[model samples]
Target chain A: MEKEIKHLKYFKVECFKGLESVELNDIAQFNIVLGDNNVGKTSVLEALLFDEHPFTLLRRFYSMMSFKGLSSNEAKDYYNSLEFFFSNEKDDKVITYTVSYNQLQKNEFQFSIVDTNGMTEENIDNLKNNTLVDLSQLPNTIVLIKLNGMTNFYTTDINLYRQKKSAEISYQPFIKSGLSYDNDLVQFFSSTVNNDLKLRKEFISNLHFLSDEIAEITIDSTTVPNNPILMVLFNNNKRPIPLFMMGNGTIRMVRLILEIMMCKDNRLMIDEIDDGLHFSKMKKAWGIVLEVAKKYNTQLFITTHNSECLKMFKEVLEDERFEKIQKDVMVYNLFKNSENKVLNVDYSFKEFENAIENNIEIRG
Target chain B: MPIKIQLFVEGKSDKKFISDYLDHLGLNDVEIIPLKGKGEVKNIPAPRLEKNQLQGVKNGVIIDADKDKEESLKELKKYANFNLFDEIFFFPNDRDPGALEVVLENCMSSTKKQDFEHCWFQYESCLDNFPQGFRGPFAKSKVYAYLESVSPVLHSKFQGIDKVDFKDSSNWDLNVSYLDPLKMFLTKL
Candidate 1:
């Protein structure tokens, strides 16, 4: 028999954003992170977006900045946005992220910003103009990505990197807080869910929590030339309406379900998972997420501050219907120690249930 | 202002008893947290202590010395980080192999104590010759019988140990020496 390969068995972040250093061991398939405001709950998810390929890793990093409303089309604004990923307190200006799939395989990603003033003019011109520049000679405010013993660099100016071809490999999906429906949803629906009958049925069934009237979902590229809109067809004779016309909760759930389905055999991270979700629908939403993620073999890392969301997660995991996956779920409470270092306090299913039932303050 | 001291107890009854005791000591800063039962005391306190320590709050736990006194204390220390807590005291004077009921029994007034002794003696004598042997941890029953003997109508109306006021001098003497150890622990907090 072959040994099972967990997606991420252990994770560690050092000097990334607000996290001075943090480590999570024995990572479960479904992890729920809880913390007070500004405790680096989202940073943990961002740190896990690293990849062995530098281009894919950089694309994910740019996407995260864009999601946080920090991405900019202007050169200076983009340079400023990149600074948020590094720590201000450290002089070295290097951020390290490491993850292990199992005991035998460990991957580390190191990112550092360099200044071009110390380098020769030829090296600076090459870094600014060329697609593949020498790693030894870097330009001003450029980020050098080191992964799997390979080195690649990207200029801080957004216009420079925009000319480079996009990475062909797909990275893990990170569904950020307050996420709105975008073109990615339409692309995923058409490329993955639309072609698969089983996935299409599962998607529609999950949407019944929003409205049982949703009979089918289709793409409406003809309604608007050169642009595609997701339309929901109702069970009644009423005409189809655009998916965006629905409530924020409905749109958010669709994006979440689509990403989970698309990221099969990969990890998916969602920050503030209960942003647009109502307390009443939380349990059902969790049920769909857990069931779908398990079916697709997608590991999950979700963060939330809402106590009601935590309660719902507890209730869903405790249900006998989810008993087989109960042991795979874990809750982690992130808090800062006296020295301002972020620490993780993880609880297994039994421990988390105990804390919730007894009203213990596990969300620090 | 945030509470500076937190004390974890076993259940609501224990919460009520400890709250009243803290009031008698005039300690206003201590917050009492009641868990489901002894099982939670072993599991819940460490995480809570870690959280509280982050906020610079002092933590302590007072659990019942059920079955064995030293073993209970040892188990608590084994599960929870010992150095994180300011104090860890067991109920019933922190020395005996008993529970809160033992402390309540000792706090009974002289007249009620005599009545409790007579009542417990008769009850034990009645069960002595029974076919089903009464393996006894009858301290709780003794305390209930003592309360009923004091005021049967009032005791009948009470639902749980928490409802019985320990401050009433006619039923209980709050200044009893058995509670001195617990009082000293609170004063330190």
Candidate 2:
């Protein structure tokens, strides 16, 4: 059975003094946030994962203290609470659930329960064993429950994935496509064939065929001799360059197409997917992203300002290719109100287009 | 000092047509400047004098009737309310500014008895083409087009023909564009 975040019935968000009691209700899975500049769209995203505080997860994705709306005191309290908020369960050896916020008062923060039976110790161990493990083997489902006293507020179960044993040799878990490893991946290919030459040629040829409208790409095995590497020439006399030398959009396309061909479980989160691309290019980008998402069972969360991004995504939804991806995708338009308060309005394609055409500020 | 008649136009084609037309009219003291879009309203030079100070500007202002003519007129009234200039003229066309090319095509076809193949081709043939990005057109084309089709009364008022030394050369060197009539209307303001 496919899993999806059906609806965010109600959400009570708090981070800074100004944004202490914002609420959102009746959220569709694919909701859009629309608003003018300086609205707290990014804040809401952070509020969900972190307890309105900066964490290692936040640091890895974006800079700390980059966003405003919180006082220095509140920011400190949010960081301090992470230690007291969650700890390992003693007897059951599972993570205990608790919800804490400024409004709840000291030690008065209450939480509801949600079971995580499918996430067994074995699966957790398998997930966190390798330093470079594929995120696919990680938890796919998140359970949320509403707190008893806090109306319209919910908390999700948090479980840490830890490895039980440690091998002396640093072994990277390489999920193969049953094809020969590219020379770059050959070191990690245990007992796999050393036929990198054959696979590399096929890969470049396949990429060339994919972009038939563009010139054919040639694979020169002698120069770099790396696995998953393609040297493509644009003109007859010019020096050939690696495919990576192309812009980030092209590189992203290359990686995504290769992953789709491989058909592996890879969840991709593309930040600013519209970077270095025009409106016309974005349609094809959306198509490629969806194609990869379907072929690899990958979940894609792309943040973009390009209207074409939404247009193409809506096309994917209407066509119903991986019809579920549409249900899985979300769009949020963040806007600042006349009061300088930030609000987010979630909308589908029709609502968004209508609002845009009519000059209606739809952010709530 | 020569009086600078700064004419802000909507686009390159309009600018070119207006500039050439004005130059032909012997308005050597006038200078035309094109503001490409409504967005450039902010950058249009404000009065060099302080608010509630100095005398009003002697220069004239002309703006297109714009897409939303009623709203544009209201805005122009507010714009002129500052008393920055003596006059502001709005020409509300039935269609977009690009329709000038079509208007020219229809006029030329009626007078010459031959349909012009392409607006771009005819425009290129008539006007001095600039580099890739320089925007301006043969200023006199719009007036020439208007004069060819408009009634004689409107023509005489808008296009006051000058005395000719030679036969057809009079019309050739003459200010054939409608800008003189536009300026004539502005001179009263």
Candidate 3:
């Protein structure tokens, strides 16, 4: 019997000049996508989330590639040829992406067509509205986010208790020296300003495991309370360290934590699983994520460029500590064909172990 | 897999004292659960814990501070929610546990004598006639050192001790540490 997948949707994309075809097939309860760079990992997701048609994509591509000097007719010809090469239609591409239930019973169930062109602001608004339409009532809804080109802004805006206000804003000078007061009012604001209050409250109240973990974090309001810190103490320290103080891996973990905590829905999509993380901390971090996912019934979809993370992930899932969380975990190795089309194979534990034994590069 | 024994010490002194004492007794399996004040043990509500809450399932042995054994036990009982646990123990010192160490000098074995002396409070350090360190079972040598290093304070008012014993009249205004006294319950296992 196949595992029960929470989300039954799948996505596919194709183009001429770039990649011929890219597809993310077999939507599992929780799945990981592993591939090399330019293997159309991000492209598959982008096409799924934002693809409209070849011309529409070509317009964006033309702007990005700075083909401004060319006439519109030339550009249109280039796009037309590109679409024809990839698609059966002259102006269209035969991009094939499939959404399938992991379980055998629902082999051919198809939901509403979610066009990839919805990447535009107007489309995003529509998509978000549509996504939220029955979200308040849906039992097993999936929410996907492809985190690419997401820059982390290191803002040092001070929330001072008694600083004089200036309407004129200077970005450089203002950013360097920021200050915040430590008083009762500031304390109240700092503690209560979480973005998702209802979800946060429920998570706090319902999960019994959090109390033990919360006991470990001590925030010192005096030194830097309002700074919004995420500190990863390799050793014990009194002062609350901010996330900026730690390495990228630590920051990534913090990002993962914040996202997981704020996600109102059960499904999450993390594009790259091992970006900026230390090899040593990957297993432990995966352990934490798996634990939280199980406790909250979260379904995770992740892409990875780290073979070590994948290997460790497999090892941990096999461990007894991960038994409860491993029920529906799936792994897929996505690769591009000679024709520059992407395809995937359901990665088995034995195959992963063999890959490790044979010294295959697990990370993309 | 091991029978977890959680020992709630009144203060750092009690923790070190009891830890060393038990180590001497070859009871290595015990865990000293520190309490912030004499009142913290009162908060653990009694109930059959669901599986999720069972992550912290070590047995609780609350060691509360008191000037008199009877009064302190009564106060401690009021806080120990019935389902919290039943193995709470109380200690009302004639003076601070540091001073109490001096009182128990003959009781501790010769091998453990050094450990006891390191934790005792001197009578000169009393806030009033009562040993000032004992005024807060929380402020003796070992306890003070543990807390100071972990969460330090700047220019503590109880540098030596308070001169006024508000326990008598309560005529003058009383200023206690207004911070969450239950913060001690947040200690990592």
List the per-model TM-score of the A chain: 0.84, 0.44, 0.52
List ranges where model 2 is wrong by over 4 Å: A1-37, A43-241, A255-268, A311-330, A356-364, B1-189
Query: On residues A1-364, what C-alpha lDDT tens digit does candidate 3 reach at each position?
Result: 0133245445444452355644455555567767678775544433332322222233333332222332233423433332322433324333333334343442211111123443456754444554312332221212222112211111111122112232111100010001122132122223432334664454343332322333122234355655533232223455445435545664455445544443323455666667766788888778766776665555566777777887788777778987654546655666644444455655444445444443334343
The DockQ score of candidate 1 comes to 0.36
lDDT of 2 by residue, A263-287 (tens): 2342223434566556666766666
Largest DockQ belongs to which candidate?
Answer: 1
Tens digit of per-residue lDDT, candidate 1, span A1-364? 0123347888888888888888888888999888888999988999888765565666676777777777667666766677888887798778887878875677877787766677687866654554355445443567776665445455454544443342223334888788777776787788777878987998888677557888999999998988899999999947898988888888988888788766777788998999999899899889888877887788899999888999899899888989888889878789876677778777888888878888877887
**lDDT at A90, model 3:** 29
Per-residue alpha-carbon lDDT of candidate 1 for residues B1-189, written as tens digits (9 for 90 to 100): 457898888899888888887777778888888899987776673566777777677888889998888999777777746777778888888788888888888889978688669868888878876888887756678787786666436544756777777777888888988899998888887
Docking quality of model 3: it rates as incorrect
Candidate 1: stretches off by over 4 Å:
A1-6, A119-138, A148-172, A180-184, A195-202, A205-214, A222-228, A236-238, B1-6, B26-31, B45-59, B66-87, B105-175, B187-189
Q: Is the docking of candidate 2 incorrect, acceptable, medium or high quality?
A: incorrect
lDDT of 3 at B60: 52
Report the TM-score for the A-chain of model 3: 0.52
Give per-model TM-scores.
Answer: 0.80, 0.35, 0.38
Worst 10-residue stretch by lDDT in candidate 2 chain A?
A159-168
The Cα error of candidate 3 at residue A329, in Å, is 2.7
Question: What is each predicted model's overall lDDT from 0 to 1?
Answer: 0.78, 0.40, 0.42
Q: Ranking under lDDT, best-scoring first?
A: 1, 3, 2
